[model samples]
Target: MDPTDTAVMIENYEAFRSEISLSKEDVIRELFRQNQDRISIKKEATAVRNLIRIIDSTLRLANSKGFHAMTLRDLCADSGLSMGGLYAYIRNKDDLIHLIQNHGFIITRRTLLHYTRDVPDVRDRLYAAIKAHLYLSELMRAWFYFSYMEAKSLPPQEKRDAVAIEREIEAIFLGVIEAGIDAGVYQPRNARLVSSMIKALLQDWYLKRRKYLDQNVPVDDYAMFVRDVVESYLLQA
Candidate 1:
């Protein structure tokens, strides 16, 4: 699904807020000014929210198997919504795939934003980003795994957007590496390559968590392992 379609829906939903007697006229006017249309923003927002829920539930089910293994009937059952209702939110399975990919990016961006806020030093920011990313994956393990693995199946435009979001995330890691080098904290090397490696290490925990658990690895221990590797590789001499 095109993100703009969702955006337009959200804008329309916002416009619907004016129906409430308590809704401020000024607020509604501002929304109209920004959107240039008094569309049913409330309904659109609700539909978008439902769409996200559908994506989340479907991905959770798909993680046990794979995307191709999941049917629309499976999604309908998993999401606890009828086929008609589900279709109202999305055109088809392909649309749902796009929604899930975009939703993952939205969630990841929100998580990183919280971690990076108010952190001045680049090293601290990087630490916070890593911790946030790992913690979020642990908390939303199925969703993260589904997003990572199912991305390849998205349509060309959706795939490009997904890759762009992934690259942006890697750039955050690269920024830290570059900072470390500039501050004489890290050895001169390819920051992008190092960033990719760091991401792999972080992702491997959730993706292959069974292996780690079989070895009796605790979360704190896993986090410490990441910190140690990063510090050893990136810290100043």
Candidate 2:
């Protein structure tokens, strides 16, 4: 795709990038807020800072090794926290898994809705959702990688929750496409399948990131390509 062809896409993507932060500290701060009752820490600032260390270290350790193979001791050593301190935030690996999954899901849902909702043009809204997801995944690649790789080994309920999160994200795209069709902005098509396909394309960016990186694919370029392909399929000639 030509850079000029995606000028609006680049603009929306840059807007999303500037307006939202997926920094570890910001994510952990929100995580701390949601899990304050479970976490023993009382000081927000201190908890946020340490939670950043703990979560970042967890992602690093889990991705380097597997989440199942990683131990609390490993986490403690990696995070520079005592076993007792780790326990203050999580009761066990199960708790930690839930925290990590919920943290990503919460931010993802929020980010998608923030970028897409209230946009009057259905085409722009769909493109916004696509770019927003791609941009956020690029920002939180480690968390995205860990979440996908570790979902199967999660305890049964956690596994179910993970599937639900994936479906909800797919549903967000489905909603946008369905709205576009209803609004007559796009030709009639299978919105659900299209949404799932868009998700698979998005996953290709994050899950096979090394392949793309080695191939010299920038995320913005990939995002515009996806938007172009999806629009070509959906738009009336």
Question: For candidate 2, lDDT tens digit of each residue in 90-186?
Answer: 9998888878887788778767766676777787888788888899998888999998888768889879988898899899899989988898888
TM-score of 2: 0.89
lDDT of 1 at 151: 73
lDDT of each: 0.66, 0.82
Q: Please give the clash total of every predicted structure, in order.
A: 7, 0
Model 2 clash pairs?
A: none
Off by over 4 Å in 2: 1-15, 22-27
Lowest summed-lDDT stretch of 10 residues in model 2?
Answer: 1-10
Which has the greatest lDDT? 2
